[model samples]
Target: MVTALRGVSERAEAWLDVERERIGLWLPVALGAGIAAWFALPAMIQWIGLLFLLAAGALVGVLAGWQRRLGRIAAVGSAVMAAGLLLIWARASWVAAPVLAQPAVTAFSAEVEAVEPQPAREQVRLIVRPLRRPDLPPRVRLTLRGDGDGIAPGAFVGLRARLMPPPTASLPGGYDFAQRAWFDRIGAVGTVLGDVVRSPGARRGSQPLRARLSAHIHAQVAGSPGGIAAALVTGDRGAISPEDDEAMRRAGLAHLLSISGLHVTAVIGFAMLVAMRLFALSRRLALAGYVLPIAAAAGALAGAGYTWLAGAEVPTLRSLIAALLVLVAFLMGREALTLRLVAAGALIVLLWRPESLAGPSFQLSFAAVTAIVALHESPMMRRFLARRDEALPLRWGRALAGLLITGLVVELALAPIALFHFHKAGLYGALANVVAIPLTTFVIMPMEAAGLLFDSVGLGTPFWWVADHALRLLIALAHAVADTPGAVATMPSFPRWGFALTVGGGLWILIWRTRWRWAGAVPLAIGIAALLAQPRPDLLITGDGRNIAAAVPGGGYALLRNRAGDFVRDTMSEAAGIDAPLGALADLDHVECNADFCRWRQGAEEGVTRAGQGIARGEQDAAARVILASRGRDRIEGAEMAAACAAADVVISDRWLPRECAGRWLTIDRDSLAQSGGLAIYFGERPRVVAALRAGDEHPWRQPDQLSGNDEAVPTDALAP
Candidate 1:
């Protein structure tokens, strides 16, 4: 046994020596791990967190004194990770802006900071800084009337509106907009109550330019194609119809519309290509040793401009920083699109906007690039893509193969993240992207650029027409693919632990450079299995406590609501993987349901399995009774309420119980549920609960008190954070 262990250690050392270059790539991973660690914690005392970081620094100092090669690597790697974790924690504290605690109606005078006009809807989104509310954060997002004319950035305006805290997750593991809002310093979000009384000069800020450009593009193009074009150029996505957007998402082409890394890379690449070509035309300039530098400078400038044009959102800014790093790498004569560049960009972005680390854009962007770089660096791929004077047909075949490989790699690399955030993954996204990417990158983008060039001479109509047609073709293809049966697969639930496992496995595989990398597949397999293993919740409650979904005795889930809008239905469907329409609670077979309560009968069928598993053998013949209440009524007679409580498993009313009501196993009332934002309850031997807002969570944006308000409508587009 001692000899075998020694042999293994020797072999590992040899492998490490051979793969020394790859070790540097893990530094960024360490940093990201640190940042992720910070976000993972619910709440930490500031001084305690700082002390932990200091301890980490001390660990690094002590570890660095070790003489062993492996010890050195561990010290450096762990130090990077600790730095990342502490850096993110510090950033959070630094940017801890004020957030509204609850929904409140008030009239306040404000200055228009920015105006985002939705030409399609003939409405506008006003970013304002309220003058009267000194306690409010610097910015608030409000939906208002009109085409957003007459309000400049500096123009003061007065308005009466009801402000609400940014929306939290509607269900456990659902989207959380409050986090993003907090990072953006948006104190409150709401719709303008009535007419806006403004000083009314002219709407200023970056929006006016972007809105005009978007409108111009829409005019040149038409329909959804025009919307796509405008989004591609100006990053104004409001013009795209919901149907088209859904199709894009289903087809896995939604990335194109987001003005992210791909668009930034393309713009920078094109700018560099143009500058290099112009310089190459002059032999003297090419020989002066300034050609590459000039080209890099041009690419950097274009990337920055494009980022600003795209609203300068964190995602766009992340891409810009990454692209700039690539340019810098090129100027320094290093490999431009390598893993190091990706890491550097990620580090810079994390330092600038640590909160973005939690967002899908940041995760997907970095993961995809890191995986792609690793793949291309492999010996087999390097040999495959090696340049040679080959036949045109062979070259085309090689390019096609590379594209397919890249798409599949990116798909696999990003699948866990996509599944974690969206609960869904595209089935044929690689196949669809094989066609869409080339069109967008080679044909559509170039045509759009040419149109802008020709428009300088007032002759760009034909180019714009060509670009519009190409965009339409892309949309048509997306629809065809999205509408196909089984184009998308959704998981009913995915726990954060599963996501962590998969991500760690992926990083292990990407960062290692030996047969040992294959070992990552073990955890990857386990994580994927875990994703499909989470039990579907038996009950779901909206944040407002106004709606409820309960699994029936038979098979299907039923809802208790006067009207379940498309948004609510879709949100529930996505979260639970219930494709069938939600049935009326009172209509389910063998279940006793009324306006105030529901009871799921035991053994309604031979056996009802969930997620392919049955309940525990802890025997019980009693039915599961879930009591619900309404808005108008809070309490009932003491004896009647006591009997109702005694007969069931849990009570989900808004805590309107009488004094004698005491027999229920558990009571989840409005105020208690409010602290959680929302929740999912799994009916079992002992009901398991998952809160949308985890316990001890004390993020700046979180105000659990705000989640308990009454008269809350089912959240929809109008109330979007």
Candidate 2:
């Protein structure tokens, strides 16, 4: 036993050492110290201390590197730098924490910055430049309410709104949006107070340069032939429509819609080619060496495109910096595709805004770049491509292969986080990218550029025709792809550990160039295994206070109460994976609304007896059993009825009552049934269930343990008597 214990200790120590080497143990320690300082020190002192610490640490790092023998010194400096970063982050959090904690209330004076209007619903986000509350955070984003022409992006308007945090819902075993929003720095979210009142200030500054440019481009390409033209140039989705979006996602062409690494690279590459060709014809121009610089400037402009001035969003800026770095390297006569450029871009972004490290855009962009660069340098890919000549067919094949390889690597890298954030995977994304990326990059971008030049030169007719045709083609492609079956899969949610494992493994595979680095797949496999091991919920109920739906697997369901709305029924149907005819439940001998007992009889062999007018029950004698009720019921009066249904494993009610009943009791009330703005519960024989109930349980179906603890009559309001 002693020998085994020693071996375990050694292994643990070695593992810790490895992690320390990779992440520098001092970073976490420093972060912890910074967190501590935020609570302990004054705000001004904290900021001063953090600034000094950063300067001192950076000096130490420089000195240590110069000495070459000061390993410990470098590590200590790194830790200090890490701690300083933490302090800065904590300080920001401190300033914002109070405003975030306050309940969202009506703020009449707010400025609308952006509007995303859908066919069914429109979202207008505003920058709440607080004039009355000067000490409050300067910029608070609020969503306004109203329909029609008054609201536009970049408009300052007077609107009232009671902002709340984003709403959360549990979809079986799935990701939680509320938690994701917290990490994303969204302090509060809520609906509009009333009809948005547009003051005279609304018209002023409504069309900023970027907004005007986006609008103009959108309008110019509105009648374009394909979806590709609009997506390639301006990142405009207004002309694409929902059907087109769905199609692109289905066919794996969805990445083209988002301005990412592929689009940037294509723009840069095209500019470089054009510049070199222009210079090749003139020796004097070549001698002056204006080609690289011109190309670099053009690439930067292309990256900036029409979406540059959206308040310096980290992801877009990061991509632009990376593209600029590549251009600079080319101008300096160095290999532009090195990982060092990637690292430089990362470091620069991290220094500017550390919070972006946690965002999806940063993760996805870097992951794709790292994968493509690594694969390009791989012996296998190189040897395989070398065998094919540089013909058009071969080039197209190479592009397709590159797209697939990069897409697969990025998907694997981002899958865990995507699932954690959205709870859905774009299964067809691999195929979509191969077809969509090439079409957008090679065909659409150049055409859009031509159209813009022509429009500028007063030859607008031809350019407009080309743009229209391109958009239509792109839309058609997206539609065709999306219409196919099984385009995406809803994944069960996995915790943070799964994300860490997946990302760590993916990074190892994509970034590490060593031969034996394939072992990274171990963690990747473990993460998937962990996700697959997650437990499934046995029963689900969905409603909006008007209707209540109870569903089981294999399309079996019992409705306790049917009201005016079918929203609950639709939600339940999706949750239960029911695709059969909706009216089939009526033919299954289920009970209809009656005067006395709400009941159902299954065939001739089975009989279900429910108590009270609103109480409902369904039982499968040889299999599972259940009891359901309407809005108000505590305990049934008839002893014979209780005894007759004594074998039931679970009893469910729309509301709770003060009564001692057999088996486990579930309730649907404000504290019991979630569908009615109440808590829901699942009671069983397990001790864990009892402990869970005691843990300040917030489900709508379970009564608060505090209420049950008192011997005095439960409040009439608390129980349905």
Candidate 3:
């Protein structure tokens, strides 16, 4: 026992030494822990704990920075964790402050904080802060219904508008729009009641510099190729068409629209190289001081300027920070692309917005960089690089092989995350990237950058035209790739625990500098197994309880209504990993649909139903296993329909069921749907039901009662009374 204890102690000491040597890794780990802690907290108590953590973190930071070797690891880790907790909590609390009985419709004088024009919708997104209400959320996003041409960023305007808080997730295991809105400081969404006439009382706020820059670029290239040019240069995607965006996403080229590591690196690298060369040409200044410092400074400034011009969104900001870290490392005469530099950039981002840790943007960005660093340091890559000075043919072969390997590694690193979040992987992403990346990097981005700079002086037309043509080719390539057979492979949604395990395993594999890192494969494999075993919900109902889709036994969705809305159909298809066409009902084995009802059955099962003409008062309807209510037909006034629903095992309706009919059957109605957001029902002897917005969502952000003011109650599908 003594020998074993000594051995364990020695191993632990050695591990601790390794960690100390790689001290920077602790920051990212702590940041992750802080985010985890924040999410683990109950909604009600989250803010309170965050406040306490803030004060504690500040104290720890002060103490830690005071001495170099006074329990340095423990102090640094504690400080980082505290700082992470504080940042997220403070931001959340400030953005999501409680407001009771905010008017849904009101006339208020407002200053347009920012204007994001959507050419596709012939509308404009106005970020407005109310002039009068101190109690209102700090900002509201208002979509002006029509062409509000004269309106620009910083223009104050007054108009009557309907405002409501951002919506919660429409379904269980769906994106949390409310959480996203909270971080964006968007208290509510509104629509203009009428024309957005500029109010004389409107005061100009700080101008949206990025929006102005993008608008200027768009004006120069207004008709033909301005959208992609503006997007590439200014990170403004407002002009890109929905079709193009979808094509890019499906082809795994959507990252081109966003300002990311590639863009930042290119912009800063070009600036640095130019600045260094210019400085070197002047021998006096070059000899006076280190050219590296001057060049690095120039690059950092360029990155910062570009980030500011790109709205400094999370992804852009992350890219800028990463660029700065690499530049600063170069200035310090250290290798720029080290793990320490990666950790520093990640730590800065987490400190700024710890919530980013959960977002796909952060995960993919950091994972790709980390994987690249690991690959660079791997024995295989080192061996290849050792022969870089060989013959020209061999060198070219090495370059091609390196590119292929890098692309593969990045795809592999991001695949699990993409699958978990989107439930679809781009089957031809690497091929698409290989074809598109060079054109984007070498041709399109450079021209766009030149266009943006020259457009102000009327010299950018040729550059803009060149960029546009390149973009056209890129788009054509993307569409071609996306349309290829098996271009995207949809998979079932992975469970949260499984995703968490995958993340943990991946981090272990990347961060642990030991042979034991292979142990991460064990958990990774388990996570994959867990995902495979997870089952899709049998039936899903929309938030308004107006639409539903039931899963077929073999794995596909059948519309409960023949003409399901886009939201219902898309959500169901995505959840079930079935890329069915819109309003597709053919997937079900034995399906029948009419204006009155839609029904389907599989083998021995008593299948699902909708309250329709063919379904009403039928003997099959009366004994139906599950009955879905008709859309826009909430009132069940007739005795026959009520009687049939009452006899059914589960009744889902959008309208009000007769009072007498409600007691016998399990009914999900308008009131419940309104409160819960959406419903998921599983079919079996004992059906399981889940609500999108549960009792816990009674928190300030999800006041269900407040959300549905004066809305009429209707019935929805219910498994139990």
List the RMSD of every prediction in angstroms: 5.1, 10.5, 7.7
The lowest-lDDT stretch of 10 consecutive residues in candidate 2 is: 702-711
The candidate with the higher TM-score, 1 or 2, is 1
Better of 1 and 2 by lDDT: 1
**Total backbone clashes of model 1?**
7
Per-residue lDDT of model 3, residues 1-721, tens digit only:
9999768756865775665556567668776776666654546466466647655655665674434332455566666676666666666666564332344776666667777877755778888876655545667888986657667767766666777777666777666777777667677787888655465444545446676777787776663256767777788787777678778888988887888888888899889988999888887878888676888888899999988888787778878887887766766777887777788888788877777887788888888888888888777787886764578988887877787788888887888888777777776787788878889889988887788778678788898788878888998988998898888877656777788788778877877677767889988888878877766677777776767776654565666666666666667666666665634554454555556545443221332343343544445433435453454443446575666565545666676566655524467777778777777776655667777776664243554223221222111211011
The 10-residue segment of model 1 with minimum total lDDT is 712-721
Candidate that would win on lDDT = 1
Residue pairs whose backbone atoms clash in candidate 1: 34-85, 151-202, 151-203, 152-202, 152-203, 152-204, 153-204
Q: What is the lDDT of residue 231 in candidate 1?
A: 88
Off-target runs (Cα >4 Å) in candidate 2 are 1-107, 113-124, 130-156, 160-163, 168-188, 191-195, 200-203, 223-231, 236-240, 272-283, 305-314, 387-414, 540-551, 555-721
Superposition TM-score, candidate 3 onto the true structure: 0.85
Q: Against the hidden reference, what TM-scores do the models get? A: 0.89, 0.68, 0.85
Count clashes in each candidate, considering only residues at least 3 apart in sequence or on different chains: 7, 38, 12
lDDT of 2 by residue, 1-721 (tens): 9999768756645544444433332343244334334322434555567657756666776765533324344546546655645644553454332224334455445455455432222444455443344323344556554343535665555545566443444343322344334434444565666665555523544545544555556656553333345455545454455546656654656666676666667766776677678766887767887766776776677566633643345555666777888878877888888666666776666556554454566666666676677677678877766656678988878867866876786666555665554555566676666666666666667777776777777776676676566556766766666666776554434645776677667666665555435777999888878776643233444322223344333435444554423545544444433422233222344443333223332221232432233433333333333443334343446463454234434444434323443434333333443433312223223311111112332221122111111112212122110
TM-score-based ranking: 1, 3, 2
Error of 3 at 326 (Å): 1.3
- Cα lDDT tens digits, model 1, 1-721, are 9999778767867887887877777776777777777677777774357446746765765665445446567667667776777787677667666777778776666778777766566678889987635545567899887766656566667677788888888998898988888667787898888766654353433336777778778888877888889888889887787888989998989988988888988999999999999998888888898888998899999988988988887668878887887777777778877777777777777777777789998888788878888899889999998888999999999989998998899988987888888888777788999999989999998999889888879999999988988998999999999999898887777877778889889888988878989888888888999998877787888777777776655456777773788788777776776555788766656566655555554344324443136654232333344444443354467777777667655666655455566545666666777787677877766668778888877665664222222233221222111
Candidate 1 residue runs with Cα over 4 Å from true position: 1-12, 45-65, 119-122, 149-152, 200-207, 388-390, 552-556, 591-635, 703-721
